[model samples]
Target chain A: MKIRHRDSDSGKIQLEMTPMIDIVFQLLVFFIMTFKVVAVEGDFNIKMPRMSAGGAPSDQLIPPLRVRLTTPQDPNAPVCGIYFGQRQLASFEDLRNEVAATVGGGGPNADADEYEVELDCDFDLPYRFVIDAITAVSGYRDPSSGQIVPLVRKIKFAPPRQASGG
Target chain B: MRYKKADNELLEADLTPMIDMTFQLIAFFMLIINFTEAEQDQRIQLPKSELARPPEQPFEVALTIQLMKDSKTDQELIIYGGEVMPLANLQRVLAREREYLTRTKRSPADATIIIRADGRAKTGVVQQIIETCQEVGFEQFALRAQQEEAG
Candidate 1:
């Protein structure tokens, strides 16, 4: 009996492109469908333990500066007035200036823990206004250098007011 | 005069460059594609601030709590794990989350609760959520905000 070998030298074997092309198209479609255009997001971190569990650190040089955000009687009102220690600030800009002045030209490596701001926000005041107040006190964008000047990073919310439903 | 083309020659379109380009595009998309489940709800408009830069280090464990305030009805809704609940009923949901964390061998104290709240949301409600988290043994929090566009 003679052993015969199969033909190993078959002419140029055509590459199968259909399945690969199909898979590639499928991936492309999947990626295009899931592509979401989102604005870059950031976080302002807070470390608040329960009041009963070791209240607050006492290494502060000064007492917490009280920044109050008040609103009109209307439930849907934005922040109407921002008072920094009894003195009413005209706007968030003024609040930022007031904070910068009080903190003595806060720099990049300023002692943030020593200076604290307690946000005493009104029950009806919008949360954005509180964020504005926080941004104003926490830091500011320096125009000349286009850098953030660190002011007070220690921010705490005053006790929650009466729940106004929303 | 009539010219006849050769019938034996097969006309073949070159697909190498097209496949190469397609593969390049796929590679590019894969490189830039974000797979992380970022909870960016459309209903809540984030507050923008110049100081709000992305954190340098990603939190090892994070739980996102979304809050939406209806402008017309003035109703507050707490959204967590794809379920919407009222603010008054959110403490129960938070307690469950703490349980889940512990079951998975993760300490609730190390987890950062990321709050993506509507700008119009009531501050009191937000504080209540934080307080609830505090009671549940989570101390860390991150107030999410949009990066301010330069004026």
Candidate 2:
């Protein structure tokens, strides 16, 4: 079958690569802009605490106060306690008292509609203690103002460790 | 006159289509840009963990603990994020913050505390930071970590 028809006259079968090239350039630009240079920070040695359900605190909008749990270097004593700013929480009663007093001190301005408690606990601390402390702080009421308020509403847990295995 | 002109002999590709594609790519990049300039050190490679999840909402308020290496040694400690003060001071800070929130009638839990530390940091150092937050009655905390993005 020898049938040739003058090579179809003009022979113009171009793929209009201009549009494709434009798209490729566009994609390149998109990737360059969207490319997030993520810089990983923190100790690469320590294994973070595995959270089951509530996992790591994911909400940044919720304000949390930092608390550190420490036992004095004395190995013989079980004097593990809480440190808020720089003071130790000697007893649960003290926490209770503080919460109650603070609420009371709010005075005429005290209102339940505007109060909350933030809890930040250490990873190694017994879970029960944290709960107990939470309860005490949460169930506080101002005696003088007669205003009941939950000390904490949103909780953000701190990282388990700062450095590697201590 | 016979070879005078061939109609449509300009042979130029229409540029509108190409411009449209370029615009699309630019839009995509703009969407993924993270504008928050967090001055974090790059040398510190964060430990990779499955636990790393970006926060749901930007933390509007936070109690920050800036951990610094002992200029003299490798030791790390809570430096600029509230240390060497009476627990009362913490209570005061919380109370003050609470009091302010109360006046505005905002939920007291509307804030977060970010505990930032060096990667070569120690557990004990971090734990101490947590204790401080607890004493002032903070119940929540967030430990930061990172992982390599897989191809």
Candidate 3:
């Protein structure tokens, strides 16, 4: 027996939207949930070509200014004292001020192009302090403009001090 | 009493706007997503610097070295190519990299060695790593840090 209803219009076939919508929502959720916020990273480029035979300090246009970071005798100290040239400094800020003055503002104030810095760090000093020192001598962010004023672009490391045990 | 059939009316809410909005949201998220984080290892807590701005141009050839040092135990380790080993064992890895570069007709001097070391790691260890890279014929180095906003 065949049944026909007077209220039905049966010619059109409707597509199912439920599964597509479900999957779309799932895709959206997956992307959103897996999304991460990563901090911007940067680098300090140091071009230290291998020293030629005979240990020549050759081809240096300007002698590098020495900045030594001294580790405290107590192995537990978090930061190191900075010795910029002959003057022993208390903080990285001091080192920055001294370097800025010595580098002088070239271009308008002085020539930072010919300037260089050689960092001599201790065997056990935390690496962060070295970066702090590098950040200090390399440049300072202008407080008002928030612009980074580069100081010495050329930075090199002195030979590592002897390891305490290993 | 007579009940009316609703199926003949073909009732459907408009879904076009909802789907359009969803696709827009997905596109926005896809645009902002950064895939470079895969190259970074979460184990190393990098040093922060306000002046550490990203380079204006990417290096032509780069090799990343992730260094980790246990503060309490002083056990240093190097993470490269997803492999971790003691710091003293890094020479072997560097040698392999140098060999690979030479075999591929690329010079080690052409590659910039990028060192991403933990903040708590020793400065001497970093220097030692540089020396090892230099010994491997790598002339260029990059010390990486997280960018901190000026305060």
Q: Is the docking of candidate 3 incorrect, acceptable, medium or high quality?
A: medium
Off by over 4 Å in 2: A1-35, A39-166, B1-13, B39-44, B54-103, B106-110, B147-151
Q: Report the alpha-carbon TM-score of model 1 versus the true structure.
A: 0.86
Q: For candidate 2, write residues B92-147 as lDDT tens digits.
A: 55666666766887644455556555544544455565555554445456555553
* TM of each candidate vs. truth: 0.86, 0.37, 0.86
Worst 10 residues of 3 chain B by lDDT: B4-13
Q: Which scores higher on lDDT, 1 or 2?
A: 1
Better of 2 and 3 by lDDT: 3
lDDT of 2 by residue, A58-122 (tens): 33343334455553344233334766646777865576667556555434555432434444544
lDDT of 1 by residue, A27-105 (tens): 9888888776778989898777776223465455688899988865764554468899989877888888888888877
> Which candidate model has the greater DockQ, 1 or 3?
1
CAPRI-wise, candidate 1 is medium
Give the per-prediction TM-score of chain B: 0.82, 0.54, 0.85
lDDT value for model 2: 0.49
Model 1, residue A77: displacement in angstroms? Answer: 8.4
Q: Rank the candidates by lDDT, best first.
A: 3, 1, 2
